[model samples]
Target chain A: MHWQLEIVFFIVLITTAFIALDVKNLLVAVVTLSVFSFISALLYIVMGAVDVGFTEAVVGGGVSGILFIVLIFKTSRRSSD
Target chain B: MTRKDNNPIVSLLSRIVSPFIMLFALYVIFHGHYSPGGGFQGGTMLAAAVLLIRLAAGREISQLQFKKSWGTPVGSVGVFIYFFTGFLALLMGGNYLDYSFLPLGLEAPVTRGWGILSIEIGVGLAVMGILVAIYDDLLEGEPND
Candidate 1:
């Protein structure tokens, strides 16, 4: 069961990572990156690194996501690349 | 471009919610030794709580909660605290970060535990301050400039 859950999380993590890179809209990309962080945190928790998982969830998903969104607001929404 | 958000719902809800988040952050920091959370997670949560208010309310109003200028200084102080703790151990005839010699009037293990707790607090404060400072800096200047 744990292995199955880990596999599912890995799938979601990779998918979000690719979407975050591929998405043209910067805001959507930021949101996708947040999702990626969340999944990675879950993976860490499953692996029993609770402290690392907690930090990843709060810092990576929460603070970094907010910072990225604010960055998007301050700059252009559309990516040149 | 620090504009006050006019949405009453967001302002009201965040105002109500931020304090609880901060309380939880403190809990996480204090209970880190026995739990999954620690300085970094708690500090980020603390910063998150403050930023929630900043984003929901306007920059001006949020300043009442946490001044914009306080971030970097608070972070500096936290780093100082960590360094001072380590230096104190060195002065007391131990290696750097050797908390057993802290002269806290406790058993060696307990002294080390206290030392770890103090270090976690310092790290938490530093993380909170730096993260908030980053947010403040990112929001500076005119949007679309």
Candidate 2:
């Protein structure tokens, strides 16, 4: 059971990172990154670093993505810089 | 959206979803001590809530804005807060991030807990602010954005 959970989690984690990388739209990418963070947070729980996981979830999954989206709206999506 | 003004779908979804998001973030942050989360996770979640507000309300109406103009300063201050608080611990003759030597009521469990919590809060602030700033900076030079 534990092994199955780990397998599922690993798959989720990998997929999350790829979603962040694969998404073309900047906003989507940012959102994917947040999802990635959440997966990491869950991974942390599995690894017995509950505190670290929590931090990762909130900061990485929650705030960072919002910041990205806001910036996307304020700035252009073009990659000049 | 501008057209979503009378849209029950958008309003209803946001009403139900947003509060849950915010609450979950808080829960993750608050329960961090005993569980799989902490200031960073919690703080980001908190910031996410703000971001959600920004998204739904439109940039014109800021629910909890730090402002693009002040992005750099706000983020920097958040980082400085985290470091400065840690520096305080160092000033009391402990190693960097050495919570045991924090001057918070003198080294007992209560003091130690207090010290750690303070540091976490500072880190949370920094993480939220800096991430927001970076996002703004990245999107700043885009055209037709």
Candidate 3:
């Protein structure tokens, strides 16, 4: 395990998580969340859990992104809080 | 969502890419036993392919690809396939989901492999159908304007 690579991934993961939570626009938040998911999937792969990484990449990054976008369109674009 | 505007480029690009995604999804499902990827991941990919079209084109146009009404039934059939496999093993005097007595006329190991394959297929289908169904249901009540 390359600790350096892992550290870099962790940094990005934390950054994206913060961005996702802090963003006011729900669409940007959703997209950032997708990026966060993809990065975590990468971290999973780095840790040698290939199957879990594959699942995270597919469901978290792809399908959930679309679902969240649909939810935004159906409900509201901006978060009230 | 209804067609808000026409963008041939988006529609055409998605049309071009969706089939390849589906093909890869099938590959993932079939090779699940030997690979890191499996039924759920592959099934989600399939749903993604279908949803790509639905998002690019409008709902009415995309219905030609996958009817909204067919989702729940397809999911049910997939579940039946899964349960029937297990129950067939049970009825054959083996424990539930025991593949040795599956009557495939193959060696024990080979029959076990076949059993797992069928289970994966069922899971893949069920996941794909249910996901698409969720997407459809989520958008069903939206007003067309």
| Candidate 2 accuracy as lDDT | 0.66
Candidate 3 per-residue lDDT over residues B71-117, each given as its tens digit: 99888888998999999999989999998889899999999999988
Evaluate residue B93 in candidate 2 and report its C-alpha lDDT on the 0 to 100 scale.
Answer: 91
Order of candidate numbers by lDDT, starting with the best: 3, 1, 2
lDDT by residue (tens digit), candidate 1, B1-145: 2453387888899999999999999999999888889888889999999999888886777899999999999899889989999999999999999999998999999998999899989999999999999988877775421
> What TM-score would each prediction reach against the true structure?
0.91, 0.64, 0.96
Q: What does candidate 2 score in Cα RMSD to the true structure?
A: 5.3
Q: Is candidate 1 or candidate 3 better by TM-score?
A: 3
Model 3 bad stretches (over 4 Å): A77-81
Please provide, for model 3 over A1-81, each residue's C-alpha lDDT reduced to its tens digit, 9 standing for 90 to 100.
Answer: 688999999999999999999988899999999999999999999999999999999999999999999998888445487
Q: Write the per-residue lDDT of candidate 1 for residues A1-81, one digit (tens) a residue.
A: 499999999999999999999987888999999999999999999999888888889988899889887877766545588
Error of 3 at B26 (Å): 0.3
Name the weakest run of 10 consecutive residues (lDDT summed) in model 2 chain B. B1-10
The predicted structure with the larger DockQ, 1 or 2, is 1
- What total of clashing residue pairs does each candidate reach? 0, 16, 0
Best-fitting candidate, measured by lDDT?
3
As a whole number from 0 to 100, the lDDT of residue A31 in candidate 2 is 75
Best by DockQ: 3
